[model samples]
Target: MTTTPRSPAYPSSPLPSASPPSPAPSSSALSSASPARWPLLDRIEGPADLRALPHHGLGQLAAEIRDFLVTKVCATGGHLGVNLGVVELTLALHRVFDSPRDVLLFDTGHQTYVHKLLTGRQTGFDRLRRAGGLSGYPARTESAHDWIESSHASTALSYADGLAKALGLRGETGRRVVAVIGDGALTGGLAWEGLNNLAASAHAGPVIIVLNDNGRSYAPTVGGLARHLDRLRGHGPDAGVADPAPTAGTLFEHLGLTYLGPVDGHDTRAVEAALRHARSLNGPVLVHCVTAKGKGYAPAEADEADRMHGIGILDPVTGRPPAAARGKESWTSVFAAEITALAARHPDLVAVTAAMLRPVGLHRLAEAFPGRVFDCGIAEQHALCSAAGLAMAGLHPVVCLYATFLNRAFDQLLMDVALHRLPVTLVLDRAGVTGPDGASHHGMWDTALLSAVPGIRLAAPRDPATLRELLREAVEYADGPTALRFPKATAGPGIRALGAMDGIDVLRRSPHRPLDVLLVSAGVMATPCLEAAAALERDGHGVTVVDPRWTHPVPDALPGLVARHRLAVTVEDALADGGIGSALRTACAERHITTPVRALGLPLTFITHGERPELLARAGLDAQGITRTVTQSLTPRSTP
Candidate 1:
């Protein structure tokens, strides 16, 4: 199917009639084993092929694509529900606009699986999100059709605004710039900033903003904007009997952009018609497309939590993750239980999350203390600043977020919380080399970033026991801000400390030997450090392994301990520069200690997607790699 080339000038043409609808296959037929023959899907390899097909064949092809996604994505453990929901929407977008020439940008990009399928990358799903394979989000290296490689939300509109402005400057006004943003991404402050700017730019070419309102970001969306969208979609008390008119002075219209729809996103013809109407308009236009997250799959739609927004390897038929994947107690679960218990004891204690009540393990706190926990939407910056306000009111607020997401609120953490010396505890989950989600999702930058914040104390728990102990210590410390971070993996059995000294825990020691080497472990790195120390001891070298529970302040006893040992090495899963290792090296230098200090951690580069163990090993942060590094350091080189 080819697109009709439009004139360079803006046209005031009427909306064209939609094609006749085809008979949709039954749910049973669609869900039954992958079809031996996907006649329409197999024949189409690109957008041109998709546009060439008869309009009546689109429904059957969508069904075939869903079945293909279920079989492939389930086997590889990638995003399922979001991709399933956007099948028709993606089809409508591709059908209406020429992709490469007319830029199409996805907000979070996880919903682009259908776009990948339509753009001839269907076979890459077999290795989805694997190292050196197809990324879970859009990647520029993979296809020309994908404009931005985005996983973080609420930034697509800003990108669209910039691209539209650039195209207008180049006299390429005929090229369209479209941004599809949703999954509660509009709740972010950045989205509003982009919207405000886009509305202000009256003649910045044609920028079509597609609002895919699914009414959820992890759980149902929160706050006033969600309510406004709900009313616009005819689901709230403020909505009257009849649907609102396109130019009824709605929020988008007031913001200076033309408003259209509350269109049925599942209907291919309807969404296509709405998009066509949007393209015909001049300047920026907003098309509100209402869709259901996990629309077709019964299991995903029935999932009360997140609508299977993300999943591990799961049963294709039942839509259930494997028993083993669910049975393990993860770091998030441990924090959930401990935080809930802590909330019961402290009435003045409160919690906040950035539209991630369940994902960051604040659901339990929200359940136990109904009014105490706040879902601040996808606005991390707002969450941090608001937590500071809570602290000012003589209350301690614990803000829970994924370590990667905390990057968004650094200015707030530094200026509002640390500068004011407020009693706010930031609990960061997934604080290390997060696997499979790719570079953008890794939680590797928190330590380096947090180190620069004055008056802030950071803790890296070694195990479940330390996580529980440090959490209580952090909340009770009323002098300044504190943060506790842990990895995304399961919290294994507790590692008993051999002894304690000045807030540091000694995990292992060489028997009856001089202090030849000191291993300073940060949080979850204790296990591998202990293993590497054992290997050094077996080779007849004295080694000591210790976990500095609070890694940021550089325990008062650390410089002296480094002074006693012949060599000191710090191990962490965070970035090497400005991490615990760098801090310790500086501390020893200040105290006039002569011992050599070495730092071991992830390099300052975008590590690709892979399993946790595999990625760690590649970065030389695993047990074997650590042992090798230590041995190599001890080997003296001849005078050059």
Candidate 2:
């Protein structure tokens, strides 16, 4: 959950560097002046200022913003390619709609940097996703203009529908509700559900559904839906265009909604016009706009590195950087390497993703064995069941999905996969307090939800190397369904950090005194546990902190470990119900080692959007929070 600001090939020592105003080209100069080279974009403060500029200058502004985004994202690590791809669409939406009043909902808010920049957040772009800085995704709390604080993919259409219905019920008028969704998001079942309902609407309310089709989700999309999209994209919107007519038009029409476009998304004028036309329509309408992912940047455009999905900061002029320095490899990177190696050995080994080949680091496997790797568009449920069927066919299928999004496929994972005890290796990425992207995208529930599966063996790796070993182990374990959960942030220094994973590291030594208190922490929060131990040690409280890498299966050594201690504390980043803490309490109760056990985790509530550390701190997960809670628990209860 913590990231050190270490950049590769950065100015070593104090080398002379130019204080250059970002290398990206800015909007045209405003006549002759002292700062004649200054860009007009820097002068514009907000949307009103942007509106003041002529339409001719908007393209220049988008270019300036793209340059600014590239420069800033390079410095502060966050989502890069998705934002760059949607510059024109973001700019056009703001220019057309009166946002904050006219609800503009961003699907999978990862692509909202330009939306943020236009809505008076340009000044803060340099510090995006950094702790206490701007969030990487759209957060309603951040600004009044941001209507929906969403980070999870494929849910905005539902929000848009509900809001539209609410507006109608309240007799609210004049406001146009627009949902900017991607081709990737369309793969989710919720989007279809919203589309089905919205398509069935009787009231002719003005709702604009912008399909920002970039043809890639996390990685190059897969499955029938993606192929259907290819037909639509290839055949343009011409009446004579063939290929049995695309699904968007007929599919929505059958469901009773209007369908428009296959418009050129890169051209702001065209997109703006299409939006205006959709706004003029009575009921729900879909405006399909096609744009290049990583639009203007040549390297991003030319490179096939995960569909130019995103990469680390590069020199603006050359778009070149030295080979990504091998620090401790991330769990995702390790998964990619290991999965590729595994697939090479076992012909039956195949990989599947819900349109997240790149973000989950499955791009290498996807590239190596194109036939073996399946990018199942944005449909998480379909991806799960498809993997189940593959497993049934004697092929080992690994479904690599983000933890937050995989919640949509719980029923499928339970009924279709777990019911049959299918051997599907689910690699759940972003399984904790995913920094910056906010609450919706955070993978905070997989442990609790998947833990209940009858045959599922849930495993979480503390570091990258363990992740590789665990992934290989899970794939080969053909008896039942298995899952490995990990967070979104760069993987910490691997097995070396844990010292030993031979049945949980007993970090704090309280050998002399009878072990009175034991703290069992899971996943990435172990770092804070170590800090909390130091804090508790200073207060003369003996603490034994254990990182139980395998929280479920309730490690065999745990009973003896718990028996040795008088009080036990179980902490996890997940919710309390059915989580590590809950499991620990159950285990203690079953083993008859009462010892006054306490569970510490996220409160039973739907947490809102904010900086990751701030959210965690507010939720009593920080070192200070842990220290206070542990101290309070040690206090004797009043009889009254």
Candidate 3:
């Protein structure tokens, strides 16, 4: 096929004006240089424009797109490495197949930056991740070409299978479904489950599974699947066990499907050829393309660790973020230091992370005790069940996971660990309302989920010192499952325990012994709770602020404390429904205490991506929001 250097998709859309470099104190590293214009990219308004380009000029077009990615992503931080890696592969697919009639889905949509550009959403890059900005992930509202609105890993094959089945039932043979899944996604059980169904004769015909293998997810994917992929590549550890010269038709074919490739993903023509060959087949086919993560950008290519999987603001030329650093350690870093110390004291202590070795702060712990740490890959359920087994086998296993991911392992947490009453500790990082990755990312479900599990205890650490202190307490409590959760932001000013009541930390006590409000703070909300309490006190209401460090058990002293105050208020960072506040109210009722208790937290809704502080304020979990709520609570109700 002949290709033109330009496409009519862009429709002469001029670039958005470049903003000045952010202040040293801001999160971005923009404005060191202005954005560049690409006559080639400007012409690319749709797939038709991309198809019109000469096959030889397609290479230059890929280069221009890659350059555009680095410039825009550096100016406004997003997934830089994955987008850089998928340029040629994306172009090849778009060039070979007609979208809309042919559905194209990205498994974990972080790599869809190039897709968005080619689909006429190029101008949305400027406001990426802001409230009204272009979403960091795909949205059904974005375009007709974007068929699915999911960012979860390893679920694409299942979606494709369902779509393929639907098309068969409706006799829509003209339409096709193409799923582009990362090799890193293979570790998840869903991928295998989908493959099992897709390989069957029932869902056969016109389903192309494009396995974009870069060999890492946050880090190198850790599982049997990676080894199988290595064998499929031929002449890599354990090659002779099956066939010395194995191809895609080897392992996947054994499952009753055709396999094609070991194709150079960077070669546009080669990828197009592979895709074309797979598209012609009457049954499901797997086209394996091996590419480098962070393919073009020098900084990303040189960085071996995660290939800059997700990034903050940075200089375009050197890829340097802001010179000023975060003032304090993030909750994950704090957990890392404590876990390292705990590992030193206890020989049986072990940690497990699901594919996120670095992001969850297990790298140092893994380095210190190589034998004790395990990376289960993007497989959360497996990690939890494995931790349960480790706990049963005379080991103290701590499952370090992101709060958003913990929801995925509810079954394992309930049946495997909680039912057995194992002494496992779950360290939850990025626990509440994480910024910028969008709705699917906010970790606001853990407290609610754990509340339902019998014998499970959850702790929300409010500050750096409490995280360290509480994590140690969680480790020592070996009778049942315990979780120590904290948000992604920097640890705030520490609030010390002035006194203890049934394992609760009394941070502040009103001089007027009889308090107007019993402020029960669950985890990271302690700082805001204290500020809100001060505001209440200045307004002539007696307030007592306490941090229920071990919040899950609903401290025995809490009901009695609640009875002392005229009213009780519980503040948390989790979802208000079934969260700490609701739990506290139920506990209060169970103890026959009738103090008017109010629950303050994020309302039941999908919190959009933005800075942590800004999102918190919007959710009414910040100091001012809390203070305003508390003040309104004190007002006398007018009879309507």
Candidate 4:
């Protein structure tokens, strides 16, 4: 449990021997749930407690822990499939290496649920990914055991390399560095950049890279790299077969890292022994631990789509909610339906996804036109640039991604996509304050960031109908780049337009009386803007709410509309700084329109995970909060 590596491990540092290799757990231990509850799991405080158990007892402990996770995640609704997949591998890791001091970094930290549970965070699971509770990913603030806090994939290898070098430089060479990376993550360019560097520095102390090949990142990992991993697993390089000491033969060996394993990731004893061997190697090494994406439970195994990668509250026994689901189409579903329809009319339309087909709702598009969809693995940068290629090749490519993930490809978006003025349409799902999964996962910065990109037509759809219409319009615009951002929740009922101006849709009009407030709503903010308008009317303020449909370039129609009202307020879910309202004010000044415009939005701070509406209200992006802010801003200033 004490993975805190000892002091001064020189080049030929000796690997610590914990105990003899434990016997593999019997099928009964894995197949059938333990009759007794998590007695061993409850007793265990941390990794040390779990590690101290005898070899045979480890199986019972793992079973207890797995059962505990199933029960806990069923109620709490967290990353169920991933945690279940890594149970035995996690046990092996705790057995092989000490944590905290050893610098055990996890790529795409969602897989660290088992790691967290083992590292004395079992108690934090009740409110997992909830407000003021345990984060969905590894959090350094939560525990000393955690180091890197990035939830994004494919950067752990780089951290491992840097940490290894720093350890050597600071004479903390005794501390070992191990990066537990997924095969899916290995597809990212950043991982390869680190690999290229780490391979070149074979002589710079030992750093063990544990390749946890789960064969997935939201979906089955695609491309040439996955096939290479398959060949490595088949050849049994990880089973202590092809020693990298003399032979520079295997792919990893050529990369200057010793190879070990096709180790059974499900077999705790085998993985422990293989890791121990890897730890003892003279130079940098890779321990390939092939694990199933959803290993233990039948429901997770049977469910092919992402193996229920992440899910809502579910019945423990059936993996289903008690009642039938009810709601209008979600934003993702709407995009899926609309985009698929767009593809039917436009044969030249193609869909591109960065390893997330189902999550971003690209499957519908893929189904409509099978080969037209291209999954570019976990490489968002490549996804964007390649989408530019598709656009340049006389085809309209919709680059579908989560709003948060799109942040990874900003450079590509600006340089490759925008500089070339490609007609690629970026479809960003889960825009605005994503409810849970914590700060790192929120899609808060897209609006501010995208606004800076020149010639990019950004469309924020407020409802299902708008999304349908906007997508059709975006695909048809071949002059330059376009993006359509939508929220995660179900789309609300459409608000019919009261009237139309230059290009804006007036959703609510207070024409009977003189308008004191001009409420400019961008995309999904239309709902709250109308609510705020009603609230303002009750307080003797006649508010006119308009949906610009497109918020970028500071629409010419907007400044003119704002001139009619005394106080112009632009509301958006994006960050207040450098957001839509700021853009409007700047645009109005350029056009010589003197109306005072105020930006109302979420503050430029890390908003915590909570219910979407609750977070919105807390951030003053909700109706009551907006009304309160506008009322306060409109109040006459006291003479100083």
TM-score of each: 0.94, 0.82, 0.92, 0.91
Residues 319-365, model 2: lDDT tens digits: 55545743646667877888889888888999888777777888798
| Model 4: lDDT to the true structure | 0.82
User: How close is each model in CA RMSD to the real structure?
Assistant: 4.7, 9.7, 7.2, 5.7
Candidate 4 stretches with Cα past 4 Å from truth are 1-36, 235-248, 322-328, 636-640
lDDT of 3: 0.82
The TM-score of candidate 1 is 0.94
Task: List ranges where model 2 is wrong by over 4 Å.
Answer: 1-39, 42-48, 235-258, 306-315, 318-327, 489-513, 524-547, 602-640
lDDT of 3 by residue, 1-640 (tens): 1111111111111322211211111123233233444568889899999889877677667767777778788878889888888888899899999987898989999989889999888889988877778878888878898888777788899999999999988888887789999989878988899988987747544799999988888898777788888775663687757454433235677676677777777777777877887777767888888878888777888889989889888876777787875345788888899999999998989999898889989999999989999999889999999999999998989999889989889999999999999999999888888888878888888888999999988888888888888888888888999998888887867778789877888999889455778888888788888888788778777888998888886878888888988888888888888887787788888988888889987778888788778888987888788778777776564689
How far is 491's C-alpha from truth in model 4 (Å)?
1.2
State each model's CA lDDT, in order: 0.87, 0.74, 0.82, 0.82
lDDT of 2 at 124: 80
Clashes per candidate (backbone, < 3 Å): 2, 0, 11, 10
The residue ranges of model 1 lying beyond 4 angstroms of the native Cα positions read 1-37, 241-248, 636-640
By lDDT, who's the top model here? Answer: 1
If both were scored by lDDT, which would come out higher, candidate 1 or candidate 2? 1
What's the ranking of the predictions by TM-score, best on top? Answer: 1, 3, 4, 2
